[model samples]
Target: MTERKVIWNGRVQSDMVDYNGHMNDASYSLVFSESLDALMETTGLDASGRERHAYTIFTLEAHIRYLQEAHEQQALRTTVTILDQDAKRMHLWFEMENEDGDTIATSEQMVMGMSTTTGRPGPFPEEVEQSLSPLPKLDREHWPTHANVQMGIRRK
Candidate 1:
């Protein structure tokens, strides 16, 4: 898998700590969203790109698993991997780690390009597609099929 440069790098703020004395859940989602903003730009959907193309990405689905707990003021670094992608949608996985290289969280998302005016799913601009073509994509067939990865799960 190809990884992007540090998409987000920051420290958990004291105010973000929860009653249990750890960084709260919402903060992790916030960091992931912030990192996605940068990824969008790199993949050619920045503010200017939207204004010119009349389309932007919209989240179709998201899944996050809390791997470990982090405390306030702990440095965090989030990296992005393009798990799978198509003309209209991009699937991504992110790993958030602390300064000590311990994984704090992981998130996977599916996002689709949407036309602002038509309010419907849309294809990306040619330039955008060309820019994203070089990014790595995981082979879905080789990915683990266990649990809720690609198939729905129901406890028996």
Candidate 2:
């Protein structure tokens, strides 16, 4: 099983707080999006790499769960795990933690590679694929407790 890697680190800004006096839901999505961008850069899909290879990654789906409230100015760190991947797509899990190490939120996303020329899902370029090859993959048995959870009201 691969270890979770810290991808993004920042504090909750005043603008990110909602009327509820805590970080807004939209801000959580924003943070996760930034984390995805970091992942892209790590895998050599950054701006220059994308331009050279005419390839980019797109979010196909995302699920976010807010576990705790975050106040403005609170430091936050996002860690990511590569749950699964193929030539054209990846399933990622990200966890947002407070300074004290409490999980504030989690995001699970499925992203796909697209050829800029075709504007459709396509396999990653050879260089990007090679870059991604080094990232540790999480075995199914080692997935986090929050991974792959079904969302619905629990009725007993």
Candidate 3:
């Protein structure tokens, strides 16, 4: 894997705590959403940049697992990895961890580039592709797998 960037850092706030005395489930999603914005900034796909390029990336899917508990006032940091990508789509993962490298949660996300002009999903702009093309791509053996982490309902 390549060197991932620390996209987001924050301290768990008292307001984020719930009756269980820990950060609530919704807070995890909020933090992860902020982290995703940071990722977009790093790749020049943030709101302003998208406007300049007339293109945007949309989250097509996400899978989040609350692996461990994080209490109020606990310091946190997040690192994002580009698990896979092509011209138009990206598969990503974010790890939310404490100071000691203990992960509190993990989020897997897939996003696609769309053209503002056409109002349809399409290939990313050259600048966007250039910025993302260098990230390391992980193979299956090294990819993390969770037993109950599949995205949709399973039925016969």
Candidate 4:
């Protein structure tokens, strides 16, 4: 895989800030999730499409590190890489950068494919996999290491 960029832009809202005046931890997850959604859209697989295919993605693991604060009104950008993929899993890396290109946060996500109705793990469909197989590989050195704590936002 080659290096490629998937852009996700964010407009910091007042509600996203905490007492410290920066984006709250939960807000960060929201931005990251939205970015992932946009990235998947590029492959013609949005939330609804996943259901239509009877294949959905669930985040199995994630490592995220915050390097800088994003205040209200700041414009944030995100770049994503495919990292790795097999029969039923995928590893992806997402980098959040400020308007100046400064790294604000990074997240490495491990996702698994599952049958929507059956709720059983399964491999990605050939067409879906083919559409997403062109993403770039992750650079080990670039994987975020500062975040050692485990965190996640489960879909309800």
- Compared with the true structure, all predictions reach lDDT values of 0.80, 0.92, 0.82, 0.79
Model 4 clash pairs are: none
Evaluated at residue 51, the lDDT of candidate 1 is 83
Model 3 vs truth, CA RMSD: 3.0
Question: What is the lDDT for 41 in model 3?
Answer: 79
Q: Is candidate 2 or candidate 3 better by TM-score?
A: 2
Q: Evaluate residue 116 in candidate 1 and report its C-alpha lDDT on the 0 to 100 scale.
A: 94
lDDT of each residue in 16-126, candidate 1, tens digit only: 899999988998888888888877898778999988899888888878878899998889999876777777988888778999977778888888989999999988889
* Sort order, TM-score high to low: 2, 3, 1, 4
TM-score of every model versus the real structure = 0.85, 0.95, 0.86, 0.83
Q: Per-residue lDDT tens digits of candidate 2, residues 38-110?
A: 9999889889989999999999999999999999999999998889998899999999999998888999999
- Per-residue lDDT over 1-156 for candidate 3, one digit per residue giving the tens place of the 0 to 100 score: 344668899999999999999999999988998898887777788888889988887888888889899998999999887777777888888889987888889888998988888888988878777777665556655666651265677899
- What TM-score number comes out for model 1? 0.85
Candidate 4 residues lying further than 4 Å off, grouped into runs, are 139-156
Higher-scoring candidate on lDDT, 1 or 2 = 2
Model 1 residue runs over 4 Å out of place are: 1-5, 141-156
Mind sharing the TM-score for model 2?
Answer: 0.95
User: How big is the positional error of residue 54 in model 4, measured in Å on the Cα after superposition?
Assistant: 1.1
Of the candidates shown, which would achieve the greatest lDDT relative to the real structure? 2
